[model samples]
Target: MYCFMSTIDPGPPPQLIQLILSYLKDGQSTTEFDLRVMPLAQDGSTRRYFRVYSTNKDSFIAVDAHKTGGDPKTLSAPNQNQTFHYLACHLLERGFPVPRILQHSSDFNFYLLCDLGEVTLCSKVLENGHKNKKSTLELYQKALDLLFKLQTEALINFEHSWCYAGSVYDRNLILENELNYFLKAFVKGYLKLTVSPKSESRLQAEFQSLADEALLAPGDFFLYRDFQSKNLMLKDKMLYLIDFQGARSGPFYYDLASLLNDPYTQLLQTQREQLLSYYYKQLCNRYPKSAPDNDTFTFFFHLYSLVRTLQTLGAFAFLTRQGRKHFQSYMAPALENFHHYLARLSSSLKLDTLVELSHRLYEQNLNVKKRSP
Candidate 1:
């Protein structure tokens, strides 16, 4: 027999709750009002979310992005609330399906957004048992279409300061931030293994080469740094994007890689290929001059996929180490995807040591699970 216990977390402070209620009231008078606050499931980020329910059953999401030590701005560049508000408002104005910012505190630390219900594309994929390829492909196609709009239509007169990372996704950011993140978070932290000086040099060189190659692609489009099924919400069959505060200017391949290589969805190889072809065709049709040749685009797709996979593994390792148990479930899948990318790369890249280390980490995780009982 299994016993389950539920502990309800009393959301934000009473004063904060009242302030949010007043904002929702928007100068309207109600004889009797009741409000219920429920904490939502936490994600890898430091942001806290609560669903606010009123007597009329109207709902909105309250975000308490108070000054957490590890706020994204500390690592990225812009204020979390500011980036979210700017990007949300920008996308919403352009007819993109993002949550509307209903209200925000004067200081911009807290805000209310349209409640986009609980079903994410990731949840929908899981509900279908990840076997309904047809349905899954349709959802992905819709997501890709929306992404096209973000890259093109949303780029018109975009402000760089609005992005958390103000600069375009450049080689240095890729090498210093992303590649180093993988080394520190996954290689050293998670696997408890150290890279030899020679291996480290080799890894850095390879990363630099890959980043340079990826930069050869166009750099004018918006890159959704974490575009995946988890960030996509489905309401009434319309897909909405959330958690886009990390958006920046970069090659289009980055977002494509993120969506296709997303471990949460674990899209099959054939499905990914078909989707890639679909996206390429759509890009050519829509922006003929901007789209790169199929070969060049595919090359960057693979490279960006590797980068995204490594960054994701780094995040999983870092989060788990930080005592975020919710991230632990993603470790094995992330490792699997990491291996998938490593296998696809050429042996001449000299990533054999990294590949071996990843396999050892995967095996070690399995051993730990076996011993847990």
Candidate 2:
């Protein structure tokens, strides 16, 4: 017998439920398994997931990727679902926490995954209410360790035949284009500001430099593009990576930024720096003969962190306005942090001008919100 407990009503869309039942009946006959769809928090992405369960049997998870909404070519240029499938299977073989693949219906855009359970790092931290700073830090450290291991051990060369090389949305392009998400959506779109030509020039120069710095990779590592507080699942005190469809090859620093500088959880500056140092040390310790030196690591960390921060600013606004998701409260403090960090990093007049323009727009938005009934 299987038992299901959901944070939300039902499990998934009616069609998906029917598909699962039909597939199970057609393919295998074990004891009846109960499906659970727990409402885990989601980010801007359209991907949806649920937890699965069965009595005295291994539990699992499921994903309804129906909203990905396109052919493989349209999704990301080259369309490499096979690579993701292979990588998941390979990683699972190596004792990673990815839910085991029980079944997949490519036509329906859904997959049944081994449930990794309901607890996440975010839920635990929030439950403890931030006063348990040490525990929070430790959880973050464990996550980073898992990430570092994945990059160094599991991701190297793992058969690149399915590589999406034709995709124009590589690191350089992703960084360059995604900056507009911040500039247009967050700065101009959400804040709704007008700036002098001088200010605009500065903003462009600032973003351009940051993009250039971030485009360099620390050897190609499989980037879980949306690795953050939400996509991580904690089961039996271990962290597991979920929502990995956006996985790709990029700088190792990419995941680090997504984790440490997450908008939902603004870890204090001192704590963040210490975590960075710890991450750097772990990387060096693991591949002592192969890893980059401390100075190089610091440069990449700062560079990629800025890129991620800007990308997140745009995602927050776009997700709220277009996707109908409410993430404004989470983004406010993150924007403030971005402004301060920009002030410290950018010395050019053009860059400073852009920062000032963004600031003006941000202030005005706050005023508007205050006056709105």
Model 2, residue 340: displacement in angstroms? 3.3
lDDT of 1 by residue, 29-87 (tens): 76356766778877777777888877654788888776632345345556767888888
Query: lDDT of each model, Cα atoms only?
Result: 0.78, 0.67
TM-score (C-alpha, index-matched) for candidate 2: 0.81
Collision pairs in model 2: 59-115, 60-114, 60-115, 61-113, 61-114, 61-115, 202-350
Candidate 2: which stretches are off by over 4 Å? 1-15, 23-43, 50-60, 69-84, 159-172, 175-177, 195-202, 287-296, 347-350, 361-373
Each prediction's Cα RMSD? 4.5, 4.1
| Candidate 1 displacement at residue 282 in angstroms | 0.6
- Candidate 1, after superposition: displacement of residue 229 in Å? 0.7
Highest-lDDT candidate: 1
How far does residue 51 in candidate 2 sit from its true spot (Å)?
Answer: 4.4
